[model samples]
Target chain A: MKDLALLEDNAPKPGLWTQIAHPGLFLGWSRHLIVPLAVITAALAAWGLYLSFWGSPPDYQMGDTVRIMYVHVPAAWLSQFCYAVMFASAIGTLVWRHPMADVSQKAAAPLGAAFTLLALFTGSLWGRPTWGTFWEWDGRMTSTLVLLFIYLGIIALWRAFDDQLKAARFVSVVTLVGAINIPVIKFSVDWWQTLHQPASVIRLDGPTIAPEILIPLLVMTAAFSMLFLTLHLVRMRTEVIKRRIRSLELAAARAAAGGAL
Target chain B: MRAFLAIVARDLRLGLRQGGDILTLVLFFVIVGTVLPFAIGPDRPQLARLAPAIVWVAALLAQLLSNERLFGSDFEDGSLAILRHAPLPLEMVVGAKMLAHWVLTALPIIAATPVLALMLGMEGETLLRAIGSLVLGTPALVAFGTVGAAVTVGLKRGGLVAPVLVLPLSLPVLIFGTGAMAPMVPGASGQALLLLAALGLVSVALVPFAAAMALRFAGE
Candidate 1:
């Protein structure tokens, strides 16, 4: 019992670490965090854009057209990353019942969809110049299209419910199910792509891509990741405030009814 | 086990009494399949090339159309609530409902595939392979659709949401199912069939638990 007391005394008081860990505590600091995050995002995006456009050289074969990768690859990466965020949030909602999980998941969907759309659009633009078509049933592109659809489906599911809590639970289940199916979908699409197109140009053998091109790609990816973080944090803070406003209105209405009664 | 079978029997009987629902699904399948020849022109070779894909797509759509009603009616009428309180586990109840749904909806569509295949100018070995693929694939479809139906059961516009939720997940089934029927693939058909069966078995074994959890959450 004395040893337990000593251990308890030595333990850090639920201060900065606790505040960082607790979603509700972070809510209080959201306003403080948002500005810095937004500024960081903007700065990184500007730098990344400059690097991609001027600093990087045109591809040996594709020339200036390869620059589309700066936008497309990053958006594609964030598209899947946002789904992964939602997937983790789904597990949090279902398994641990995290208060902020559903809000995070719901907030992330539209952003994911936007990134996915950007990826598809840029990919098609790239394809028109390269493959001579706006669309190709290539594995990565098709699977990403399906991912966009899944994101849309989840957003629609969220809209279908008037009760946000109920929608959260339902969407969480669907998101987790989608997460499980994603690998299967990708595998099948890869198989299907192989059947139709034997030679794929998107091989990632290190020596093939020059350092100058790869650097911009990485920088752009970092910029996109920062952008997602900024957006997600802002959205989550907004969701929290929205829920608070809703409850306050409901409480006020109840109090007014009680006074009348 | 008895209670499980009883739920299955009851759902089956309820489905049979509403037999027109099944007929409508089959007719929709036929209509969708029939439209392809006209839409793409009556070029027999083109239709033959496209037949497996058309049939699989039609089957998927037809299955999706029926999924909205899988748990919606029970949810609305409060039977699902009573079933939740029954001795049988909700997972088993879900399994039984999916089984009933497969029997009532998917089997009829699979049975109607031969006619649709004929209309598409697919015959001989290819038709047999198509039928074989549909038989193996539709259970997975029904399983996936059940999960969609259960997830959306409490929503007012559940029918609208079910397809969006289910269709992407069904793509693999469509890919493998059509691949199984492709005559040009030679030994690929056997491999595709094995994969399709594996998908079906996985869906059957695991999807009901997910559906049951969704149903319980929706009920709450």
Candidate 2:
């Protein structure tokens, strides 16, 4: 009943959206998160977009087409990274029973799925002119497709449950257990001879790409991270509101049942 | 030990009384394997080259189909509650159930692989490797499959959803199973069997308890 005060009092307020959506609380959830994130994202995007189109050197072999790496490589990184986030969140939620862990995990799923699709599409696009085929059943590509399926499966399992709590727990288990595939996706190229290039950015000797390319790739990575943050926050707020509405409806139903009795 | 064996025998008896559960899974494996060559064309060399991977994949898929049998009916009937409350730990009960499942589903796949290999024109050393890999790898299938089955046991339409949850975790088996047989294709046997054996050992040690916990959660 005490928790219901916010719902009972605020449900009729039209001006609540402006207050709830205030960027201050969004950014203030963690101290100084938004400012640094905004600065880094803007700087990187500007630098990367400039170099990708105008400044970065063309590969001696691939020419202008190599620019797509600025997009494709970062997307590939984020797809894997987002899944890791989902996986870690899932584990945290399950083991510690952190409520936000569930919220963040659910929020991360669609974001991860989107990144996976973009990675696949971009990889296919890059493959067309480079590999002379739109796709290869090579270890990396095949594993990426598998990763996408894992994402879809998690999301599907979550949506299938009527109770959000039950669904969250189910999806959490699936994500944590399926974390095995992340390493496979990351190291698939090295483990198996594949058309996809071996790790260039995070290798032991360090990134093989020049600063020009690396800068943009890092920029794109930041942009992708920020995009994930923005979207997840929005989605989590939506979930919290939806849960509020559901509880209110249940309360109303109980009250009506009591009145009839 | 009696508790363990009793559970195993009980599951085996249940599987038998159900009459066609084990046979249907084996039949599904053979039929799917046979149909694939037809669908893809009967190129003998190609089939021979793919025989190990194909047989393993078919076995894995068929293993997925049989997974629903692991805890589905028992969970629904509240027998699982009795098992959980029994003096025997839930882990041992799950372990016994998983072993029985291996004997029923995986053993058939392994037994039929030699025949399936012959049909695909796999010869001599390759055939041996294929069967050997299945023998080593199938336990992992049961281990992880039991985990997935436990996780989904209380949900509606759990049977359809279990494979999607299980398949990714089972990749080590698929990878090592196929990898182990790779050398036999070229007339040599290699680390695939070694890795397959390792995965089986690890899964046997770890998966049962994890699966038991998952079953406890689903039951809740």
Candidate 2 docking DockQ? 0.36
Model 2 agreement with the true structure over A233-252: per-residue lDDT tens digits: 66776776677677778778
* A1-261 per-residue lDDT for model 1 (tens digits): 333233224435568765654555657777798889888888888989999999999877778998999999999999999999999999889987765788899899999999999999999999887887999887888999999999999999999998887788889988988988899899888877765566765533366677888888888999899999999998997887676666667767887898999
lDDT of each candidate versus the true structure: 0.87, 0.74
Task: Name the top TM-score candidate.
Answer: 1
For residues B58-144, could you state the per-residue lDDT of candidate 1 as single tens digits?
999999998988888898899999998889889989988888889999899989988998888897788999989999999999989
lDDT of 2 by residue, B1-220 (tens): 9989998998888877876877788789998889889887889998888887789889999999888878888888889988877889998888889888888888877888877888989989878878888899899888778777877777786666778767766776787777777652332246557766877887788777667767777777
The DockQ figures for the candidates are 0.75, 0.36
- Off-target runs (Cα >4 Å) in candidate 1 are A1-24, A200-207
Worst 10 residues of 1 chain B by lDDT: B182-191
Model 1 TM-score relative to the real fold: 0.94
Interface RMSD of candidate 1, in Å, is: 1.0
